[model samples]
Target: MSGRRLAELLAATETQTPQGGQAVSFEPLGWVWLKAGSRRRRERTEAGVTRMIETMRVETRADPRLVAGRVLRFDGDDWTVVAVEVDAERPGRVRADLERRP
Candidate 1:
């Protein structure tokens, strides 16, 4: 996925409870490779999982200065990010892959 999408996903995967309950974290299941001559496959890794969780946290904060992307993924849909791995792109930018069930 592109950096824009990743930023969007990260911003959407987060939610705030009534009184800011234990921040729920959404970890990336894995990436499904869409190959040309073979069936799709998924490769899960710790780094991916970590990125998923961190992005959620970064986007779900109380700061209103953060900018979130428009990329979104619904539940049951397969998605992954290859580039733009982290949410440290620039100031006031929350990097994330917005793949969460609303």
Candidate 2:
């Protein structure tokens, strides 16, 4: 797809999921599936950064085909989840930095 097309798609998705979305579980290098209407978790730094920390919700799955990873597929678009850090307290949520893949 063209860069413009991809950008448009992401923008649409962001609007649809303003609260963010859920990221299914997968391995470090495994392919992941991401969809809209998932969930979003947010946090705010009381004094330090003075900005809210937002992240997408992620949940693990027993089946290998359905879990978390650094790569995600959504709406026929592929995105790479970079700087993915798991929440120490919440096992189901992950702080994922998303970037377009290819």
Report the lDDT tens digits of candidate 2 across residue range 11-53: 1122234458744443333433333234334555666865544
Worst 10 residues of 2 by lDDT: 2-11
- Score candidate 1 by lDDT: 0.32
Instruction: Give the number of the best model, judged by TM-score.
Output: 2
As a whole number from 0 to 100, the lDDT of residue 40 in candidate 1 is 32
Model 1 agreement with the true structure over 29-100: per-residue lDDT tens digits: 322212111113333357556322212221322233233433334333432332222336445433333222
Local distance difference test scores for all models: 0.32, 0.39
Deviation from native of the Cα of residue 81 in model 1, angstroms: 3.6
Per-residue lDDT, model 2, residue 21, is 71
